[model samples]
Target: MAQSNKYQTGDQVKVRVDSPSHHYRTPTYIQGKTGVVVAICGRYRNPESLGHGGDGMPEQLLYRVSFAQNSVWDRYRGPSGDKILVDIYEHWLDPVGV
Candidate 1:
């Protein structure tokens, strides 16, 4: 497992989609969106199945990510509402470039 930079609560970050295995908290809609790292949720064992449930799996680290409603949807007619928070794994993030 790769060591993750210890992210403090409310640290802003950008998350990228690597691959959608079987189960992950990263929603398909936000795969390539830039968001803030809201909280560190600790490490979790990867639960992706290799079509047979026993191969090509790696341990994963989890984090809570938050994104503005306006940042996610262009035509979101609904009130911008509160930002959405997602529990994302480490493999799903990359540092955002300014």
Candidate 2:
């Protein structure tokens, strides 16, 4: 069965700022940061569960999220248009207005 994606390209989303004791792939630097969905990278097995020696059932939808450089870093000295793209799982993201 195919999983339905919660977000689409151009959707605004915020990364969840969670610090779980278990293994996770979401980077801490991008946590709690807001970004726009640039692409849907399809579904894949959950890495966190795999890392813990559990069967990675229930794949997760992955999305390419884009964030403004200045928004991600307080002292970013790059152009105002500069942006960073991060591959984030659906579980780590929340819709900006919902």
- Write down the TM-score of every candidate: 0.71, 0.96
Q: List the candidate 2 regions with Cα displacement exceeding 4 Å.
A: none
Q: For residues 1-98, could you state the per-residue lDDT of candidate 2 as single tens digits?
A: 76578999999999999989999988999999999999999888999899999888788899999999999999999998999999999999999987
What is the C-alpha local distance difference test score of candidate 1?
Answer: 0.72
Off by over 4 Å in 1: 1-6, 18-25, 49-52, 55-58, 78-81
Q: Which ten residues in a row have the lowest lDDT in candidate 1?
A: 47-56
For model 1, residues 37-77, the per-residue Cα lDDT tens digits are 87888766664544456653566678888988788888767
Task: Please give the RMSD of candidate 1 to the true structure.
Answer: 3.5
lDDT score of residue 69 within candidate 2: 93
Global lDDT scores for all candidate models? 0.72, 0.94
Q: Give the TM-score comparing model 1 with the true structure, all chains together.
A: 0.71
lDDT of the structure predicted as candidate 2: 0.94
